[model samples]
Target: MKQGIHPDYHEVVFLDSATGYKFLSGSTKTSSETIEWEDGKTYPLIRVEISCDSHPFYTGKQKFTQADGRVDRFNKKYGFTK
Candidate 1:
């Protein structure tokens, strides 16, 4: 590791907006936002659109959809060819 050439790494709070789930981890990502954590300390806050808390695969709610628009043979099999 080199000194004075690396980005500042520190603890950060990642928030899942959809579920309001928050977890602590280290990151080099910087944010102007901050939040008071459950431990009564504040860290850099970053909001994400999706996280494991609300992701479909992690929640076992993923929809199994057939790929239906790219192949002519697939369309024919589904009686969508004209």
Candidate 2:
């Protein structure tokens, strides 16, 4: 391990802006924003646009072409029979 060569790693709060979800984790990223978490402790706040809570894949909200009759359209385009 090297000294004075590593970024500061500390517990920070990641806030999902869309879902307003927040989680505490350690990271080397620095932020100028601060937030008081439920633990009554102040930590750096990082706002993110997407997280597990708001991600389509993680939340199972992903839309597949199978549901919108795209297969039928494809079949018609290719002159294939059902």
lDDT of each: 0.89, 0.93
What residue runs in model 1 are displaced by over 4 Å at the alpha carbon? 65-82
User: Tens digits of per-residue lDDT for model 2 on 1-82?
Assistant: 9899989889999999999999999999979999999999999999999999999989999978676588888888999995
**Model 1 lDDT tens row, 1-82:** 8899999999999999999999999999989999998899999999999999999989999864544345666777789746
Model 2 steric clash pairs: none
Compute the lDDT for candidate 1: 0.89
What value does the lDDT take at residue 7 in candidate 2? 91
Question: lDDT at 20 for candidate 2?
Answer: 97
Q: Whole-model lDDT, candidate 2?
A: 0.93
